[model samples]
Target: MGPRVARCAILASAALFLYSCTFFEASVVPPGFAIVYGVSDYYPASPPISGDSYDLTYPDDDAIDMAALLVEQGFDVILRTNEDATMTQLELDFAEIGSRIEANGGSDTRFVFYFAGHGYGDGMDSVYGSSFPDAWDSYFDSESGASEPTGSGAFTEQLLLHDAMPINSISVQSVDDVLAVLDESLSDDELSDLLGTLPSSMQMVVIDACHSGGFRGSGTAADTIPESYEGWDEGVSVLDTLDAITLYLDYGSGLLDVGASDVGERQAIVISASGEQEFLYEGPVYGNGIFTHYLLQTPAEADRNFDGLVTANEAYAYARDQIVRVENEFFFGEGKFVPRVSGGAVDFVLFEAR
Candidate 1:
């Protein structure tokens, strides 16, 4: 079902003692466009394990909740979940939404692309895939003088399809023919919606509620999980899984450095649910992700400036702290999930600019 637009009114207290409530017209900000993706299950064989090693229950909830929030923000939101969250589907949705925004809006169009799902990471480049990968190829980059991965093809970053398979080279090339006009590369537009919204403008971002193995040149996600499943499938090695993470952490457009150079300005803020080397934990504590839970229901304490406008930086800091507190209470400090914020404009208006 599509996200129905409804008026969202938030009561802001002028003072604890006064108990007076000031309502915000949700429309304080112009309605924007949003396409959200969430996956509670992974394709291929999900390692038969229990507890935190198996399928999650709240990722889909997280997506729906975020969509509701976006709708409240006056966005025409499109929600995609489970098998529908394939890589190809993601690309197509962006292209279609981009076209719509291009035709009806201008550089001022606010667009948000959000995803909450499973993410695999090598120590360096993670290609957050919705589907689990069964293969990985590693090679050296002569120009960057670093080692990179080639999973199923030469492209560095990729998303998994509904059957839990990555889009093959032929499919990617074919789709690029249609998507090239936006940024001349699927990776560029895939990283962020280019054809529909301008990155230089406010209210546009690629916020992912996924995990990055480590923050740039550190460890991989393997360090958090049990090593037994490292070789669950004969063809898929743990290293291959590491190479499959597609969340773009690079300063450029995409993970492979094939990204659009102009995006280096990092016009908007992209929020990650956890840090590079942390696990994105989903517990029944709230039947949803802790970071996401806080992100949606941000504690009143987040209005640090007391200015009524919750800037991007303020929201991120507040959520990250809450994630840490909740995880510590749940895992007894054995596991940690810290959210991260990338791009710039920490002062960008996230909520009402009042």
Candidate 2:
């Protein structure tokens, strides 16, 4: 046969072989890292009018367990729980994750980020908090037909850090400016004390129960919160969230240092405890957050292909099903903890659980 005819025959034969073969696709777990955060306690509740009464009971345990799980899977884990989780610290941790992945080399670098705690999603942004609850205003606004006062800086979603941070008062500045607020030694409460130490003329901006003030930028020092921070997959980049309730605050002010976040796209995979619009469940049943419990405990039967390796898709389905079943048995039927998974293809190897 002519060369062209022979080539066509070979192509057809190869296609047939591949179609007939039942190969178990093998995707190994890449050298990766993870950042896990969960808040079991929110010390400062929002105003009584806000109606954020319930404090999470399992996030601290969730963080600890998730970090351990990642470590078992051979991932470098950085864990933060309860009071240690502040907006500033969270942002820095994210940057550190990016740095670690880059240090290990980019491109094929893998990452798994897990958060088990309080999360709120307005029509636009999903707001996550350390231990704080969303305010009543979070539920409604003029755009949603509420008669409440209108304002700029409306958001689609944001992850809240620290405790009792006003959605509007969140900082949205550059990482440099955010870090400039103070050395990493300053805790959220210390941030408040930092303000107190400032000249009386300088205002203060509280980030959480630990910190309760804002800076107007009167002093030469960089302002914290409500500045500019970019990076990340979407929505508000850094802090720079609108501090809408400023009328009641004594913060001076800070700016988000200009520039993009240095943290690369380290969030290769994110396993949030709940969907953007839902709240995660925690109970004594599994002795941990609902999603987290299932994540670590789903039967090995989850290996649908029985290839000895569990893909992320398989693990997610298994965990989600188990979470629903357990939540229904123990909690109210109406309240569902819909776990969410985003970023990267679902076919990646999540765990080798052989």
- State which candidate has the highest TM-score: 1
Cα-based TM-score, every candidate: 0.59, 0.56
Backbone clashes, each candidate: 12, 52
> Taking the tens digit of each residue's C-alpha lDDT, what string does model 1 give over 1-354?
233322221222225324533343233444477788877765544344332344557878888998987777667778988777766777677777766666656456667766666553332223334232222212212224222322111122222223342222322233332232122112322463343344325553434434331221211111223221121225656654654353234333355543232122244455666544345566787877777778776535577867666666777777867755555555533254556555442346565432
Worst 10 residues of 2 by lDDT: 206-215
**Candidate 2: how large is its RMSD?**
15.0
| Candidate 2 global TM-score | 0.56
Q: Which run of 10 residues does model 1 get worst, by summed lDDT?
A: 213-222
Error of 1 at 57 (Å): 1.3
Q: For candidate 1, what is the total of clashing residue pairs?
A: 12
